[model samples]
Target chain A: MKKDELKKKRIIWVIWLVILIISAYFVPFVLLRGINQVEASFLYWTVFAVAAILSTIKITTYWSD
Target chain B: MNSFYVYLALSIYVLIGFYIAYKSRQGMKQGVIEYFLDNRSTGGIVSALSYSATTYSAFMMIGLAGFTYSGGVGALGFELIYLAGLSLVAFFGPRFWLVGKKYGYVTPYEMLGDRFQNKWIAIISAGTACVFLIPYLSVQLMGIGYLMNGLSGGEIPYIVGVIIASILAISWAVIAGMRSVTWTDSLQSLIMIVVSVIILFYVIYTQLGGFVSFFGRLETEYSNFLSVPGPGFFNFQTFLGLTLPWFFFSISNPQVSQRLFIPKSLKAMKTMIKGFLIFGLVYTLVSVLWGFSAKLLFPGLQQADLATPTLLGSEHVPLLLGLIAMIGITAAAISTVDSIMLTLSSLIVRDLMQSRDEYSDKKQLRIGKFVIFIIAVIGIIFASQQLDLIATLSVTSSVGLMIVVPTIFGAFFWRGATAAGSLTSIILGAFTALYLQFGNLSPLGLAPGVWTLIITVVSFISVSLFTEAPKKKANEFLGYLDKELEDKNIL
Candidate 1:
């Protein structure tokens, strides 16, 4: 956890984070195309739930010692 | 007009609220940490749910429904920024909590006061919180009244509804202070999630026939509603208006800051933030779908704000829908009212009631309860104005929190920021928000939230850089910042 390495790691993590956020913008349309309202809502929420869990892991592992 | 049951249900709800408050009084704590931040004993589930309940209120369901129905769905882009705002807030939670613990910074203004060595800034901030929060609080009262009147078949008067609602909210705030609000919010959050799911399912079933039919129907019947704001709906100004100020506001708001102080560990902080993000995404999608259903079912409604409850109350749904709608509205209103009351109570007691070191824990708790009672009375008076709940709410909150951008940024980033810089920003931001909201003076039809942010930022930056930084408290201020962060393991 030297200064340069820490800075480099943060930059890489931030880049991936941006990609994840952009991907989320398309989630509603993808899920909404399904046949039933309940199914669609469940699908959309599932994607959201997964993303949240992934981000939480990334934050903890990266930011916290 | 089968609104009689709405009134009866509401009456029973308020009575339960009073009982909860009365019951929680026995458990009131004598320590500051115990009273304000729940002794950091709040579990993950309770913390997550309380955050969601406090974050999304009648403002989200009723108020935002009006905005989407009238302003179109493109306006929902504002919500996307919230995902980022909330997540960032979560990330910063550990740092803020650590700092708060080290310096005894219970309220947001305490941080400001310590940063600038200026008590006036804290006083102004606490004052702004009180003034802006009352109208916002009134909106919750009005929403309760609306539900009561709509449900009771016009049997219960709006004034009685207001009193019943206020007393219930004040009672809750009084007994537990933050502790009761946290547990009650957890309970309310569960109710909101269940009711929200039920409404989404029923609306999709009755209106669109099913999931497949809903999207197909949306494409054909409400194509414009689903499209992103581009052609005539969104412009550069609107995009700037909706997104930028909201990002700044979310981080700076006192209620959100209060959340940052509650978590005990970094892990707890991350979980809470992630929970809120998921909640925001689900809640927005379900609420928007409900609004779209409103569009199709009642094409010629006078007010778009009433669309959700009206559609729920329509004969197509069951008696259960009416009951859930009543509870959903109540859940949203109570969650918001409780949080606002907590914020108002803290601001009055900690920042205004006594000098910083002179205040005792017991005295602060007493003053907090007293402030809650005062706010409840004022909210009742405001609810009698015959204004729509959402409009009054947005205008008032916009005016009150307009200083958030400058004040918070100045605190964290601007090393050269001065008391005068904060003062000018507060004065300019408040005036701009007030003029746009009350005097109809948003420059070239801009949203007041946007106008205020711009004014505050310009004033704060210009004043800070151009003028000399104060010499008196420079070393002490730096020491405070260093000590606050070092102890918290932030850096």
Candidate 2:
């Protein structure tokens, strides 16, 4: 991969990560607050799952570089 | 519940560990660097496993579980944030590897010393690490002792457990240094992952019925446990306080950072990074689940730290599985403690004792072994004191070590970073962290960790601006590193 392309990919990944982090904090503290505990728990898990998936995807790019 | 079963299992495990240590001694030549760093020739899998074992300690099984049990899903978030912090590895790992291989630097402090052209930087960094890490090491030993005593139904005393752990931790490192420790850490990491996975599945299916039911129960019955400040223990500021330092743990902790030096090639280093991420994700999930499981089955426990022991001792858990869990936790603690002991010994022998060029590698090797023994003895003594919660003690050490992060980043990334700035930042930041921690002061509700980091960064940058920069040396080191990295197509 070209250095420019790699840098672009990294920048995109960082933006995705930041968005996920915001959503992770938002869901539990704001959006899901006062929601049913079970539903909120599931929402939190979904957020974590998404973050985990994102992390795995990021790590998979290691070999390409 | 018999102490005999616990002893029997542990004896077999220890014997196997000793065998691995003996095997690791086979191809090793006598020299300080080779013994301390496996001649910087560690392969991908062993490096990955050793890194995993070193990073995830008894704290995962015992301390983290308890943290989740009492603190709720916030614990999960805190830990995941730590996982996210590995992104820093993606940036720093290759840089460290190239520099280490190029300079033949064994200890992280050695890198700092050379980078800043100040021996005092190396001395202070090592000394700071020693001061904080000793308590951290003792906490791991204490975890083993407590787990053993708990698993044996009080038949085996905690002191005996401490002795057993102390012996294993010391013997493995002293036997063949990094070679033995790396091999054993690989084995132990496997055991930790496998045993934790098995137990997690068993509890989720047999005890909680399945994931759906488990989640259902937690949602309905323990809603408060699903969010921050659920029980008011993990308020936002407090959570940040607990996690901010750990967010920088990849660079701040020297044991893990030093492993960046050991992989044989860039490809091998990539393998190590990928392998550790996978291992870490699985282990972190299992550990968090252990805490959640404990909270579900045994509510109303007086102390959060009792979560693991209570859950394992419950009628639903099999006796054999409990014994395996005990061994897994012991392996986790010993894996971590042995690495810390080795790193500390290297810091003392290679960085400190050999500073004046008065010793041979042979003499250094002997001194390194002696230092390992001495550290183990000190750890045993400290563990016997049975200090505060394992999580608290571990985090305190981490927070103290956070003072180094700014200086380290400056050394690597910024050309203008000066020796005076680095030294002042570290000394002041370290003292401030310790003072705020021991004095129990947190200004503006921020953790001492966050404050110390702020102060350290400001001090480093400001002092560097006003002070002399090692322009020629910085350019030489960074310039060569850049050219080499580009040549190798690693950047």
Candidate 3:
């Protein structure tokens, strides 16, 4: 891999990251509906808990040295 | 017995922390790296405790009680998983330490940039971090004002308390950077743990007669306090959405990453993890007890955030009550606010504006302090508005971080992911987060963040596959990682 190619790839990777962030604007709307406030809050936490656990796994497996 | 004393005691704590920072400035390096990251020489206990204190702040007081008040015992269930997050950190901390130490990595952005060799990754990351962290710090200040006024019988105006607390937070946090915040956080953690335990015991022994008696009383007064809410709390999309993004967030968030950068050894990392696990469990139990006890003591109350303080006031013990009211909240607000300020300063200086040329550490420290001052002012303005602490933090941080997850993960694990793919995923995810957070429109009656995460994952994968990946880019980024981690035998 040449230096130019590497820089270009880096730019592309960043662009991809931005797309993911923009997509997040729609997450809560999709999951929270027809639920009571208590139920909704609980569900929000449940997703957070699961996500924390999964991120932990991903960090362990893939975080490069 | 008034808010004056609470303010006085908090002032003393701030002074001690600032003194530590002033003294340590002599031993620090003359570069931005050393001032902000402390040259990665932090020990296990300090790193672990600091991380815990930063993560568990005023929100625990203002928000958690309100949650329990509104949701019953189900609120406790949320914190139950916090231990799992700590354990994950414990396991990951050692590895991160090894890499950070070997490569001289200072900020979370450094890790992403080094891994992907992408400058935009670092820039966007730092931007997202500041957006969330600055507002989050404001919430802590608001908590302090709320606590001081409540304890002082409304003697201290909320604005005055906010001003005093904000000024101190910036002083210690800006001066010492991580060096000061870490030590202050350690002491704050000790105070919080000791005071919480003491209060818990006092309530058990005096209020309810004993631990056993308290348990018995709880059964009679609020038996459902210990039980989980029924399937009403369990919707498929909601549950998954709430829990799944956290997995992405834990690994992706810069604040957590910054903690992992410290730790003197693998053993120190392990101990810190173990300590937080214990603390997390105990903290959850105590908070739940405190919250439910509020319901038992105050039969008719609309605002749940006041439950703990109200319970303390009911006991008729002035000094102990004042201490609980003052220190309980001081522990949460000061510890959290300072860390956020320090973290924000680091992001701006170390991550965003880092110069390639050799620079004096003193000069960088001065610049960092200036940034802290600006952030403190912004926070004061933000907190003056009435907003729920948890909502404020979630709006500012969680959604943005949730979007960053897939791209961060891909950068580390997926060789096929492209630069374009990373940017698109981040933009989409952030937009989705904002939409879910405040939008009027919805699809299938589900929250937008969930849809955001789902789409982010799919888009990231789909884009990587369909588009031609930077052929030489993968090897180059991997090459950088190999060089950075290889010397320490980390890879």
For each candidate, the DockQ is 0.14, 0.31, 0.05
Off by more than 4 A, model 3: A1-65, B23-26, B90-95, B230-242, B245-249, B354-363, B387-396, B440-442, B468-491
For candidate 1 chain B, the 10 contiguous residues with the lowest summed lDDT are: B227-236
What's the TM for chain B in candidate 2? 0.98
Q: Interface Cα RMSD for candidate 2?
A: 3.7
Q: lDDT tens digits, residues B173-226, model 1? A: 767677777777777777777787788788788667987887677666656555
Regarding DockQ, does 1 or 3 come out ahead? 1
Model 1 residue B228 lDDT score: 41
**Chain A TM per prediction:** 0.55, 0.72, 0.41
TM-score of each: 0.86, 0.94, 0.81
Q: For model 2, how does the per-residue alpha-carbon lDDT over B389-471 read when each residue is reduced to its tens digit?
A: 43344557888888889888887779999999999999999888888887789998888988888999999999999999899
- Give model 3's docking category: incorrect
Of 2 and 3, the candidate ranking higher by DockQ: 2
* lDDT per residue as tens, model 3, B98-216: 55665677777766665555667667778877776777677778778877777778988898889888887776676667777787788777777777767766666666677666656
Model 1, DockQ value? 0.14
Worst 10 residues of 3 chain B by lDDT: B226-235
